[model samples]
Target: MEKTREWVITGADGLDDLLVDELLALGGSEPRRLKGAIAVQGDLAAGYRFCLWSRLASRVLMPLLTVPSGNPDRMFDDALKYPWEQVLRPGATFVIRSAAAKGVSTHTHFAALRLKDAIVDRFRQRTGDRPSIDTENPDLSLHLFIEAQQLTISLDFSGDSLHKRGYRLAQTDAPLKENLASAMLMQAGWPARGEGRLFDPLCGSGTVLIEAALMWADAAPGLPRIHFGFDGWAGHQAELWKTIRDDAVARRLAGLQRPAPRLVGFDADGEALACAHRNAESAGVSQWITLSQRSIAEWRAPALNSVAACLPAEWAADVTGAGQNYSVPGLVATNPPYGERLGDEGSVRYLYRAIGRQLRETLPCWDAVVLAADITHADALGLEHKHTLRLYNGALPIFARHGRILPAEPELPLAFEGSLDDLPEEGMDFANRLQKNLKVSLKLAQQQDVRCFRLYDADLQEYNIAIDVYEGRLQVQEYAPPKTVDPAKAEARFKLALQIIRKVMGLHRDKVFLKVRERQSGKQQYEKQGKAGKFFEVREGQATLLVNLTDYLDTGLFLDHRPMRLRIAAEAAGKHFLNLFAYTGTVSVHAALGDGIHGGAETTTTVDMSATYLGWADRNLALNGLPDSHHRLIQADVMAWLKDERDLYDLIFVDPPTFSNSKRMDSDFDVQRDHGHLLRLSMSRLAPGGTLYFSNNFRKFVLDEALQAKFDVTDISAETIGFDYERDPKIHRCWRFRHRV
Candidate 1:
């Protein structure tokens, strides 16, 4: 029998024309763009070529036959009439996938089911056995497209969605699907050859970077992928596929230009940076790219002379590579957070303004491209737009704006004033007066830049102790008595001092409710009821961090751990990470979506003891889109599971509560006493040459001197405390331990 071969490239609706152009570039003949597909007349070799090089197409479909039908029954009958024997063996596994537009059948599933029955019935009638359906994975995949009364059934040549490039072992929140990212880059007019730098400042998961790199290198994005749909198809052409891949490799190797544009990404989150680096390495482009953990405010444009200096070094090291570096000026591009994903509308607006201001101030000469949700926000950039193009990103309308930096605007003034002591004490009662006096003393310490300083009167009528951190130092003090204090008031003041000494140092907030509890009674006295009262109240100049003492047990801020969270978020983008005892999954969420690189197993998995905490993790994941199938959430004891689970993780966070008791685990754990055991268990699950971040809020915690023999621990407690912990910065102790391979 003579066979007819045709190439069909599937793309996002409204992008078939672009796919046609891409197919034509890959040597397809007579390409025609349909409503949702691009058809090209090609031999088997052309099919292979299209698959390897067409970045815009979702997948390449090879048509066996196009049967015409108006209704479900006729569609099924037409499907059965095809020469099934030629396409599949009697006992082979297969699956049918269908898509229906408005004018077509309203129920896509029913249409798909009918087609499935027809295929089975036809095969059954002929050979007394039918091919089995394997939806998860199938030997052969059949694709059906229905529009209006027109139905088109074809063979799925690419198999799975082309975006599953196989390099990703894990995924972070709200990952941009691969095809969508490629489409976005293509739409942005990113040049294949450039000395221009490509920057994704908010490079969550490194999707944009990897996609751009692949395009620049002219490398087939699917080369590293282990499987392709065509490999399992009945009309599979191994020789053609090899030729196509070999040709692509040859082009990539030959087209490898010297002095490729400097590709860099930066984020304020450490976990994001780590993830980006890992992803770039996996993609085989780490050497060509740079990833940094830096706030957007810290980013400075490279000097032209600095770039020229690199040219000489490059020429000395590799003259051939030097020639490749001169293609074009650098380009800075990123998809900043929109209200739907990262923050509320006001916060997102602020973030956008920050982005606009930073780019305008720092990268005056660099070309800029930004993907934003609407024209209004794009206008907020305040840069004269060279061009604006509309595109749909996951159903939301987005405008990709290209422009140069505008004239700089004056910097905004600081929002808060001087330290707590400066607060007025007029009209306060005795206790309030004492509190005001302590606030003033703390302010004085801050002004002096004392790392640790304290102020309190020993004989204050009601309370007499205050602790504060000045310039990162810790200070404690007993308040001196005011003149003429009564004996009863003195006794009360003395009791308050004893309570502070005994209980204040050991206070632990309830993870589930964010409540403060008495260590001895195990009862929560202050509970956080909702978000309204649960914010960390900052009186800015007076103190970097302050809590609403009456509304929530513990302030919404963990001042001491602020620096650590910032560090984790900076390094999070591309690394596979594990966060144990994850309260609210804040660190995990930050790392999964912060920036730098995009897309990889540097996806973070969080495990905690309480389902309540896990539920909070779920909300955090949804809040960030880091909770896809690739992200794992386990409600279990980190210690117990570390022993049982053998899966190795790249980064492990082991911040256990100071103490815990659960009937579920049949044990009560105290971090101060059990940290050694906890650290060991966590280290057991660490990948060779992996890092474990261990921290505890037990102020009096003494490291087990004996555990030093097994692990090398670097105390980072001082470095991890942020300015917010102005009062007693050493709120917790932290260490980074790496297993000696």
Candidate 2:
């Protein structure tokens, strides 16, 4: 009988199509989409080739046999009867993993353990010595999928999940999975070949940019991975794997275009930038990227012509391949911060508003694709939305807003012709101060050449304010009242306020749009409302840090941590970093990129208890170039992992919540009460002389008296926090620790 081989590729949610297309492009048979998976028919050699080259696949499994069984014992018996000698060598290390969908089995682990016993018994009965189970790093991996009593046992031809594309050496909190990163880049419509800059403004570990560099160079995303299940399979084809690798290498060499466009990342954290640079180095593309440590406000685009001139000759040829001059236009793409799981509603809104402002002002001609949950935020950019593609970063439904800046609208006279006394007696002072603040902010933004600035006064009553700053213009409006008697009336009142501000500044009425939203009770309530509001009015040329202060506790910016995220991406090349208490894992993604010169591929691991936050972290990782294999997301308590696992990491981020009950670990974690213990435990897992970044948002968190005795601790809070944090300068405290031992 002719041998028939089947392969499966796993991916993030909604990525089955990309994986299928990738497989077909590689000459595999038509791929069939399954839940979170893609199946294809090919020869063993083709399967191995797929394992080695696929970028969007998480794992490539080769089915060895399928058996029908009604019970666990029968399933084991059928699995044991397989030709074990053909697949497993005597005394080799192996592991069994099982997944049971509905109608198949209820206990997945139990099913997996049974299969393991069967495989071992088969080996032992024949050879008297059995392959030992090596779960962490198995020589051979077997995957069993049971669906409705139909058992499918396959050898994980891609060994470690295809997501682990061997380039990463360190990790941080909630890093993006490698495959998901690739998928996200694909979804973002990242140009396959372009000299235009690809940026991850909130790059946690440099996953998005690194992936873009790799894809841009036609480098196989899995080139750095060391092992594959095909390496040990009975029909393993070393020659084919070699051919695939060699072909990939040859393509990379031939595709080497000169003066690649600046693949840049910005994060505020120095450690994160260091890690990103290190990661880029590991990925072997550090030379193709640029890393910067600056807040979004400080970020300056490279000269347009300079960036355009950096395009390789070949890219010009390829663009001309379609008979068009290859003048690669600059494009700004990023996974901006959202309030979900990463920051409070206030911080997320502030972040979105800031991003909108930056795109509108500094990158007017440049195209931008922003992956955000609330698509309405795109209106804040003062740009016309050309298209919006729907995608899910895990379960968070997001819209990829793609557009270029629209021409400036003609100015109109203020709609209101009334004096301050015309306003309600209760709101007269608030309105006057708000108008004054808007004027001051607009002037400051223009003076600083800020394309988009925010003017907000959270403390103001009746007229809490937010303004959008644009070139030669300002858009001012009142935040929605805390509890509105009539939202329509309140909105009208806000419009009047805007007109008053416009008239005061002698600006056109078309330059400003007033927005009002009723404040809700809690964070979830606010998120629902924010999502419901779709788009809020964006003030042009406002100088404050946040655009929408009253939408939630946080406006659209987290100005304080902007520097930290930028720094992490700058330095994350070719290093493995860990992010603990990675709320949204923004820093972890930044550190995955090496310094752009070498385009490093660092690995990152993000840990958090909230699945909601982890989902956001995963999206951040995907938005960057980090692959699933290069990053790990653990929905477990950090303290428990410190106690249970002995894995040593190069960079460790220990940013813990102030206090919380962690249902995942079944314990109450108080950073103040237990930070010393937590820090000690995390440090114990750090690689020798590795750096441990410990931070807490608690303003009152006191350092443990004993911590200084064992390690070097430096207070980096001042450097890490940017200019936006107001209430208490010490809202969060960060310390860098280096092990003495």
Candidate 3:
């Protein structure tokens, strides 16, 4: 008999519960879950068995010390007192890895260097020889975690992550890891009690099916491994470990004698199917798995009665026990593709709808789990998902939808219904110019598949107003005429321009709207023009934003900033993004969407002064399937908040008004006078190699001369404004800044 000790097992982000279940089934006691790990009391053999058989774990750690450090220096002193000769052999090469613990130091490399010094000094003080340090191939692997006020030191028992099961020699372009696959399987109830049949419609490289077969045969996950961290430990019990592993091999042989479980997989790529066949063969589970090539949109599921007939001959012949009655529909689990493309969302949505249609109509009683990264695609499925697991696959945050498939009503796609309008007569000069502008702008809009864009921007002298198309409706703005002009003449000309616009576009009177614009600053710029609080949804490149054409002087989205918004989306992935004065959080949404909709920024923080605008920002995020959990929204004065923030960001956008006065503000803001101080504070929060964009709509705004000598600033006004906004080059000025390192 061996004594019991507490052991810690670390798993993936969302698999702690599954880890506890596996640990309990493997002869462990008092299992408890942690943030990203699990703890249990087990003996030597218990730990060895789990290291060999448990499939849903990343590493198995053996703790040496756990204590609270009220002082920072005490942690280093405590490490020197720990017994290093007990498990670590003399003269053996070892290395220590450190992760930046929160509320402590932000430099992880320095912390790791300090920890190494204490261990070497301890070994030299005790023995005559100094232990060698080998980072590439170390004999012992040490882990040091310095959390807020606590310190945990442990030895890495499982070397080279347990997810590398040694069977996947060939894989698809984006293959799923083995442990994540096992977690999905357990969540779908495979081999739990009556876990019988399983199917994968979009199986790539056969990761899920092979994991399922391995679980069914009761085989060890570490059987093919040649090395572990404990191999060089002086206190390792080799005889005890061999006995435990031999018993597992005997159990695996006996389990193989029984009937095999029904497992099937299909993929559209021939090369991917070939890799799946090769991988299954390497795992020695080829006989129990079936592979096929099929397209999702064109393929349909087999009836419940004919399932057994379609299976392989060997598995189909046996209709008893594990292979029996296959009358019940089994689980369908798979991972699908998603991302942001310029004009390819329609095709992606079609693929997801096809997946939902087959699951609902062909397989009535089956349970299914699907991994999709885009929320819009998941909605296209048209099925009520009972449970959703949000996790990251590479750089993408994806949702795993689990539910029972049943028939549901499908949504019909809407199309435009209208005839082309006839050209106006030769005398109508304003109408002729409007049609010409539309010829170029409308074609560009259609090529990009965008539904909202500017059609005319004061093209003719008499009709000096901007016209924009939102979906099928129109917004017409009339700039206040010069004071010298006669009021009667100005009013009559505005009416004529309105009439021409209505005739040229074939729009009803109710479909068109008009607003009068004047030189505004501060609170007047955001004042409401009308109380028609209605909002309509419009599509930009990859984001669907809400636009109110009547309530405020300006819509939620700034049409002039379209080019800059797209640039943010292209460069925001895996970076810390910040957006100041984020009116409605449109740019923040683009940052989260990143490069089809697949990748996005690691996190985004949006700050503004208006609570009403922040509430609107929150709604805009929800429409894009984004939660405030990762994208933070704060309501505060931009200038005050900038001076107090200590966190650093990789990308920052600062777009302020030329002049502003608000009751909540400390003082009235003038961009020309306050920009120097505002920019300095914002730059202080920029991380190394980070970028900050400064933009304003004031026509007379100028960059301060002192800024050029202190920072690396480049005026990108010509680049940030798009072709539609080229007519008015001075509509806004944009500059990119960086630290002068």
**Which has the greatest lDDT?**
3
Cand. 1 Cα-lDDT: 0.62
The segments of candidate 1 whose C-alpha lies over 4 angstroms from its true place after superposition are 1-6, 13-17, 89-91, 103-105, 125-128, 192-196, 254-260, 300-328, 407-741
Q: Predictions ranked by lDDT, top down?
A: 3, 2, 1
Q: In candidate 3, how many Å is residue 207 off?
A: 0.9
- Residue 661 in model 1: shift from native, Å? 40
Task: Please give, for residues 1-741, the per-residue lDDT of candidate 3 as tens digits.
Answer: 899988888877767677888898886889877666889999988888778988988888888876574444666688788888886897788888876444576565666666677788888888967888899989988887767767677888887789889999798767787887887777777776224677787788999899888888888989878887777676789999999889989888987777877788876577888999999999988898877654442233332234432333332212223323343356777876554311233335545665786566455556677877777777766655667766655556776777666543343222222322453453278877776777777777667665677788888877788998887888999999999989998898888777788877777888898888778767766567789878776667656577888888788889989889888988887799999989888899888776443457778999999876676676666555453446788889999998789999999999998888987789999999999988998999999899999999889897888988899999999998776788888989999999998
lDDT of the structure predicted as candidate 2: 0.63
What lDDT is reached at residue 289 by model 1?
Answer: 71
The number of the candidate with the highest TM-score is 2
Candidate 2: 10-residue stretch with minimal lDDT:
314-323
User: How would you encode candidate 1's per-residue C-alpha lDDT over 442-488 as one tens digit per residue?
Assistant: 46535633223233323343555444332222233334555577867
TM-scores for all predictions: 0.53, 0.56, 0.53
